[model samples]
Target: MDNSVLRHDMVDGLEESLDRFPDAVSVAMRSVPRHEFVTDGPYQNRPTEHRKTNTTILAPTAVGRLLSALAVEPDHDVLVVGAGVGYTAAVIAEIVGDSNVHAVDITRTLVYEARENLQRAGYEGVLVDCRDGADGLPEYAPFDRILVEASAVKPPRRLLAQLADGGRLVMPMGVGEQTLVAIEDGDVAEKFGPLSFKPLLVDGEQTGSIVRNRTKREDPEYEGRGWHAGHGWEQDWIDWEAHH
Candidate 1:
């Protein structure tokens, strides 16, 4: 199948489900060649996980919703955390000028590959750095928009501080029940649909560790005694009270 056709189908699928895709975000999605960003995958409306790190290039539907929610302007300074393979950054660069986009990842190898991929995708100006996603690129602080690809229980203070006045930040919030949140002025102003993403690592372990082992107790299926009885049951809260 032709890649362009696939791209159109992917975008069309997202539009059908989402009800709308903003003009700017739609244009960006159409412009970038997502196939170039991944070595092998369906490249439709599903995630393409990297074998080594388990970091995924989010599905077109998810990326469309996120970029649409972000509302990135052509001149806005944007920061993207966990820039796996530079696909999201390239899309953002297509919306904002490439020079206006900065992306960071804790995995050094991923950063290198992302930089190369961005260049290959003709987004050479998008800065790709190896750093903890929690840091939010202080050198490029005061970004007009910040997008975190990882999930966290709460917004990182440093990332929140880096948002320009009246700027927007979007990310998956919560360790157990993650939701896409749009933050403004240090507060979660809006919450979107549920999401599942790897937890953001703040240790700055630049060693390019592919696997960040999470506590087995966090998984609800772990022997059935784990916290949080699956999603939205609030069972974890009751368990916590009992333990206390």
Candidate 2:
């Protein structure tokens, strides 16, 4: 019934199941109360849907993998794309200091939700913004680590550009069979797993959200595009006539 007990069990499960789960990351994960972010089954090591967001609160083991891949250090500036409920950012803030963590979510509703969740978790210093995740937080550029929760065919160049030298960017790559890959200096440094995640969204495709940056036409052709929705770019950005 106690949050601490649940958090403890969550971390214990992670350490048992994952190889090379970093000690620092586990300690940070243990310290954060994930229940503040996801009110349902916060310690289950399973993904849970965020209320009304169509986004998932990542499993603790997945969070453990990303944190370990990023290799975060104390005071490191970290950017988290797709800040679902803010749990991942809060956990990272525990290791990197709340002031040093920044996050972005394309859905405005989730952005507000994440902000509230972080504040309630005592991580009010972490900044969460509503914006397309591919456009990494440039104001906080040169981040020591960047983690993108959504899957993409390739890392967004903007996110890669925002990374500080010697920094790492960990994200799920590919559409059909995603691999959690870590990138350094524009190259893949490591790859792990065949995970499944929702496609990285663009400025206009966020679920339950109205078209942002209007004049950005609502995508009318997406229903026929099959499984690769958005594919990290807006439908209008491509010239269907020329490509076809």
Give the best candidate by TM-score.
2
Residue range 24-87, candidate 1, lDDT tens digits = 8887888899877886764657787786775777888888878877889889999998888899
Instruction: Report the lDDT of model 1 for residue 181.
Output: 89
List lDDT for all candidates, in order: 0.79, 0.85
What are the runs in model 2 whose C-alpha is more than 4 Å off?
211-225, 234-244
TM-score, structure 1 vs. true: 0.84
Worst 10-residue lDDT window, candidate 1? 229-238
Clash-forming residue pairs, model 2:
none
Model 2 Cα lDDT, one tens digit per residue, 167-189:
99999898778899999989999
Question: Would you list the clashing residue pairs of candidate 1?
Answer: none
The local distance difference test score of model 2 is 0.85
Best by lDDT: 2
